[model samples]
Target: MNGRISLRGLRAKGHHGVYDFERADGQDFVVDVVLELDLSRAAVSDDVADTVHYGELATALVGVLTGEPVNLIETLADRLLTVCLADERVETAEVTVHKPQAPIPHDFADVAVTLRRSRL
Candidate 1:
């Protein structure tokens, strides 16, 4: 009964960077999460209570993105991972934070940090 839930492209404006201007100006952060858990109860009961409510999880994650100031996308990714693991049902979680507006001299498509955690 193991199941996986994926959430992608959760965006929010965040003041997070090593540079003062970058923090002050803020930038959009995109998050993608994969949650692993048992889905047997939810599958049989047909109730959201039996599984992680992704909509609610998204709101909480956005709050984290917009609420705090961090110096690295790695930290942001860790914070997002923490949120994903808040649900006891989640046995493992993977979070990826994309910083599309990263301050780089050369042309780059994106900069991102991906973190994975498990409760064992």
Candidate 2:
């Protein structure tokens, strides 16, 4: 009955960096989320109510991503994790925030922060 829902490459524009220009010219942040929960109820009842509404989840995440300006991606990741674990049905959640346009001197493909949390 255990199940997993994964959402990847959720892109949103936000001003979340240390530099002033970064705040002025917002950049896109990509988030990937994985949620673990019991699917038995949803599977048997065929009700969206029994399972996490991923579409609504995406909207909530984007709201956080674009909501406030933070100095670190770590803070952003933590905020996203809070949103991920909001539902009681979600036993565990993992979030990865990717900053592809990070201001790095050397050439880099990406910079990301990944955090995982579970209910106590």
Task: Tell me, by lDDT, which candidate is best.
Answer: 2
Tens-digit lDDT string for candidate 1 (12-117): 9999999999889999999999999999999999999999999999999999999889999999999989999999999999999999999999999989899999
Candidate 1 ranges with C-alpha deviation above 4 Å: none
Q: Estimate each model's TM-score.
A: 0.98, 0.97
Q: For residue 14, give model 1's deviation from the true position in Å.
A: 0.3
What's the lDDT for residue 25 in model 1?
A: 98
Off by over 4 Å in 2: none
TM-score of 1: 0.98
Cα lDDT computed for each candidate against the true fold: 0.95, 0.96
Tell me the lDDT of model 2 at 86.
Answer: 92
Number of the predicted model whose TM-score against the real structure is largest: 1
